[model samples]
Target chain A: MTARGGIDLGGTKIQAVVVGEDHEVLGQARRPTPTTGGPQDVADAMAGALGDAAEAAGVRTKALGGVGAGSPGIVDAGAGTVSGARNLPGWEGTFALGDALSRALGCRVALGNDVQVATDAEFALGVGRAYHSLLGVFWGTGVGGGIVLNDEPWLGRGAAGEIGHVVIERDGLRCPCGRRGCMEAYAGRGALEIRARKLEAKGEKTKLFKLMEEHDRPRLTSGIWARALDQGDKLATSLIDEAIAALGVGVASVVNVLDVEAVVLGGGMGVRFGEPFADRIREAMAPHLFSSDNPPVFEIAALGDLGGAIGAAMLVA
Target chain B: MTARGGIDLGGTKIQAVVVGEDHEVLGQARRPTPTTGGPQDVADAMAGALGDAAEAAGVRTKALGGVGAGSPGIVDAGAGTVSGARNLPGWEGTFALGDALSRALGCRVALGNDVQVATDAEFALGVGRAYHSLLGVFWGTGVGGGIVLNDEPWLGRGAAGEIGHVVIERDGLRCPCGRRGCMEAYAGRGALEIRARKLEAKGEKTKLFKLMEEHDRPRLTSGIWARALDQGDKLATSLIDEAIAALGVGVASVVNVLDVEAVVLGGGMGVRFGEPFADRIREAMAPHLFSSDNPPVFEIAALGDLGGAIGAAMLVA
Candidate 1:
């Protein structure tokens, strides 16, 4: 049976995987996202990543069944276009990402929202399989969410499950999206770094940036955060604490509305912090939850780093 | 051609109606809800109101096809019990509301959450007929919400659509439920009245209570608010403004997650304030909406005061 390829295009990195018919990963590849180019440059990197994954699987790109990608933007699946992917350089407008990738790889390509695809993967094959309804909270460069209702993904008017944008405090802080008091304003890694830099410039001491340079990394990836925590960096700890607090209120607000059966925490920060941080968030949710007695069961995503890629592949499957 | 009876059990009033097959109200009656009695008194009042409607419709209570009611609380449709209806005097635990009403009216009674059934009505026959997914925001004694997804009600874990409980601010004012920062903390009429009284006692100028007394209202009903607005009562206006602001953030947060196709505004204030307030809410949602360009259609509940009762009658239909 021919293998299928999946691509997870995120703000900081691109992950690609080749999977067999049983949804078992055969091979995978990762590449740094372009920080200076346009959508075309990102599309090229995606193609290259899939090519490497196919090579690792002992198959040719042309022989694959299909390829699917999870992109951070407004995905028009039928039109094969992506729009408003601001996290990517010079990609503030629509681009024919699907067509471009398909042409380069000599196969069909399907697209979906990055976080939503990861959520779908969890629901179909990971910890979410235990419940009929779930909320997937992906804490990465930016906080993202995916919602499942009655075992089906709920893409509300093409933009549902925007948990990151939910206001945690009324007009309290500025978000990366220029909005105020959104959960992402505090919890998203990108926002956290910005806050760190501003505070560091104002005389606060921290090893976050120094650690990034020591690791030869341009961005404060999850690894840098983990290292900072290991070193007991006070600034990093404070920002993370604030993030957890924001997530506690923000996530509880979502649960108060949907009252889903379970919650799965994934994404960079989620997977990095793991069960311990999940407990902290759940504890913080206590005071804000409307149904205090019947809280949703919380769990970390079981599929780990490859969850997004696998979920993307399901778009074609 | 048998008619059906429907009851809307609210915090301050009990409304009942007998409806024809076409969902047209054949007869209706309204009665003040008892503030001093327990669940039994509230149940008795519900039966008396239905009896008056049945009498006016020239049909015996037992001769009607069936009866349906919309009650506020944790409703167990399977067991026909309602629990935690705190707004009703002395009703803090499970009560066999369905069986009690059935025994009094000599008919089978079906029960549902007050807001959900009203939303069902709007989706089936009211302004919500235009959309496949809808969110019903009922602004009244307390802010209530009901959700419909893909033309079906989405009741997740038996307690979905608690839009009132969604936090609007971090560590904000205390809610009637004793929770902090909840939308209902600022917007619920019960909370509003309490604040008005507190401010009045603290020497704030307001004709709100005087207007309530002049209208012979046992509580500050929707009519009293409208009258106070017309008289330009500063305190009432200020309180209402705060409620609207809180609702703006709370409702937008829900929209950010659900992204339903339409929003139907019902309940006491919604119907009383009508189109203008709905517009105000729409404006308020602008800043907080994730997909601001593709906003949901907004409208006041078209069925007016009878929507909830009519929706309840549908339970038997």
Candidate 2:
């Protein structure tokens, strides 16, 4: 009957929430991630956020069942530390988030990849709840995926469902991770915007070009992409289709390896374009299904971005 | 101090061995696989082989810790059956190998996909024993891999590890599994033979062609390929390099996700080619490694094909 707290420490935003045993959110807070802060500063910021939520919910932080934080990058679950995160500005290796946060909140804490935490949240309380086996994919700044098997997180060597780095092209574009043709390099939101901007600079006749001209930026935003889609822009559709296909390859690979029941798409970009985008991914991935009779069903995350914070809380139970 | 029995069921041979608590092979028996027989007949033959091996080791089949089986195809471990297989002629859709064998031998039996069982065997008993994480790859008629995390197999859903079916290209080559651009489509031994035959038919000069002329067949066997490598055939080297590179993509993806310590290569092709092929895989996969400081170590399976049979025996334990 006690409550648990969850924190999602992302590159851009930090979200904290307190959830009851029934998985209902008691209180929540969000703020931008610290830019020039060390691990101590980041830990302090996380503590403040958690305290604010706890205070709003009228729950003592020490009385909470547990706390779970999902961060970006390689995390040592056993050590409960952020080993190395490249996306965030200064967290290079082995940030003792668990020890720091546990000390601050007076409870046990678990850490997971942010995308994986979102997936866990979805599997526990969102669209993935209906399926015993699910693959949760979040396509935002980078592509990330998590696998839930039999309603429990399947953390394989702390890397169960990393669909983003799955290679779709042998020698295609180089990725920051030093891999070529990874889905993250082609299907992530950043990739979509980069492609749109390239087309715009070349004076391409597409709705994306016009939107970029109006925004006066090299990259396209999710809203701009949605607007372009609304205008029936063929170029935007084509680029989105390519991104969906790439994402499909990564998802299908997971299906072939894991044979999960459903693939739930979350993150800012994954659910932004809505049902049409999900349909495109399903259509592209159908041919590569594990078996002819039964393939993975694709769905959108019900809790959306909040899934990560929810999953973080769910980790306690 | 209990002992277990393992069996590696291959098209040409059947190997049964008793492994002690320390993973040492106490006794082993090898026999030819009966090609002219029904499924039950083959099952009986395999049972007979194991019974003889157990007797030779002075252990009762029932008293043995466990029996494990490594065979080709989609295996349903829950039912201890081979659900479907492609390479083994008529072994399709749930053959009760575990049941029939257990009934005959009077012992509990565990069954798994051949590649997966071997991976387990290697992870527990071979080169992979040195690492907390590993991916075992067996390259032969088809390329298959199994994930080993902390010496345990990641048997997700009904699927274990079917890395061969991961599609690397969207529109490249058609696979027998009804997928396009799958890693197996380009790197499987069948594909290699097909590529070699096509090149020969197109008047490409190479030692492989010469060997084919000598054998009076258009197809090249593993032995022939070895001879070509010995002769320093440029075309053969190029083909081998290309195949290894493609296989590296799959391995790299696994490493990127699993962050495993080693990749153990088994099967005849992998073992016969040995360090040469393994070095190439390591080199090709290195650039795709996630960290510059450390990369997964690639090694030959010390247990060789015996890994399947050894892993099979450990199943009961």
Candidate 3:
């Protein structure tokens, strides 16, 4: 039986997986990303990870059908290169990423944006396969999204899925990308942390104050907020509501324009918030939809943390 | 030389043009739309106008290559039919509009949404041809836009251009489409008129007060507002600025998402405000762009009101 491979070269971690043709995980390995590595070193680390996974699984690299890697930033799919990725720092200006990875794994490699790779995993094995089209939005430290049309990722010019950077507010707050009122600026984890810190500095009464006391510098987690809400804290609940509202607004805009069937909310935040958060987002985003009552059914990611790994594996499959 | 025919079925007027294979207009004709007429009656009137133009140019029906009609609604380009149109009431459920017109003119016909057709025109022959891709925005009673990719209109799903319905504000202003805070609700001319009437009824001080007195009811117009602004009316200037800012924000969202090469502004209002308004929008939209200065250029339509007609001709050509 043929085996497929997946490689996820993220900002903080590197993961690779070897899977059977049925998508069952045969072997998997992960490690922290190299802090001082150049693009070549990063590529070599990715190659080593793939080798370890394949060796553990006793899978022949030549038997692999496809290899898909999820890297950061603007990926030019046609040129098989990373055009620009700010998060990775070293990978910029059209690195022949796919070629390098293909040579390393001795298989055809399809390089995609990290978020898009995550979406691909969702489409292949998550709740997305049933739908004709899906918009997967990942709300984490930074917000990122990807679109899957008919089981294939729609990589528009520059492999763009910058749904997070889409401006939601006309004259709202500034974003890290030097834009004002982008969805990321308001709804990203960073934005939520900033809001929470401001409230704390103002001496507001809340469980978040206690949550901050428990953890150094608040850690600023969506998971922490979800826990606070579960414990029935009003301030935390309001913050969750605000986050959902902002995200819902962004999701609604994408649904109205794209006419997708389902919107799968992935990433650490989405997984931590669980189905209840998904429900709140679904309700919040419903009124703004152009389609029928059944518009886009919001769903949590089926793969969870292994979404990038699973999706990356499928890239090879 | 064979001639290609083009028709623009607007709400109030029907415009037709006879063009050569090179897209040069051989002859053109325009007539008021029969509001009380049925489908066949309207088709006959449009065919008569086309025939008049064709005859004036000494071209026979046999010498014509094909005919293209650009109307307002969800045009099924594959089937050459307009399924449903809100502007043209009762025109719903897959009317073979192109077939009807083709039979009337004894020639083959192609169909497209009016805004998309105009966008195609700009992409094919107008200023947009200089660029590989663009976003064509038509600001009429309601705003509509089209995406031109690789010199052809990229009509996703049903209709080609529905940029007006893109939600700018979630749960803000009530849109006529039963949505909230769509670009159409706040920036459309219809929305502007609605706002002007409400303000006038409350006795707001402005030059529009005097203009409304000249007309029986308060009517908002780009011309009237231009004239009022020329006379140093602060209200008119502010309203225009407000509308332009909203449009800029919307266009910024589009540019950041699509990353098109240029944005061509057309229709009645777009041409009226000219380059000054276009410049302001370009400046406002730039900050939210993905590639900074590498974002789309702002351009005015060179075909004027004939953009749709010219684009229709290119469709068949």
- Runs of candidate 1 with Cα error greater than 4 angstroms are none
If you score just chain A, what TM-score does every candidate get? 0.98, 0.82, 0.78
| Top candidate by lDDT | 1
How well is each residue in B241-266 modelled by candidate 2, as lDDT tens digits?
87788888877776665566778887
- How well is each residue in B185-258 modelled by candidate 3, as lDDT tens digits? 87777677677667768877678757756753334656666777788887677777877877887777766666
What's the distance in Å from true for residue B42, model 2?
6.1
Instruction: Give the docking tier of candidate 1.
Output: high
Complex DockQ per candidate: 0.85, 0.41, 0.34
Give the CA lDDT, 0 to 100, for residue B30 in model 1. 95
lDDT of 2 by residue, A252-277 (tens): 87677767788898877877877888
Q: Taking the tens digit of each residue's C-alpha lDDT, what string does model 1 give over A229-302?
A: 99999999999999999999999999988999999999988998898999999999989888999999999999
Q: How well is each residue in B60-157 modelled by candidate 1, as lDDT tens digits?
A: 99999999999999999989999999889999999999999999999899999999999999999999888999999999889999999999998888
What lDDT would each prediction earn against the true structure? 0.92, 0.76, 0.75
Q: Which scores higher on DockQ, 1 or 2?
A: 1
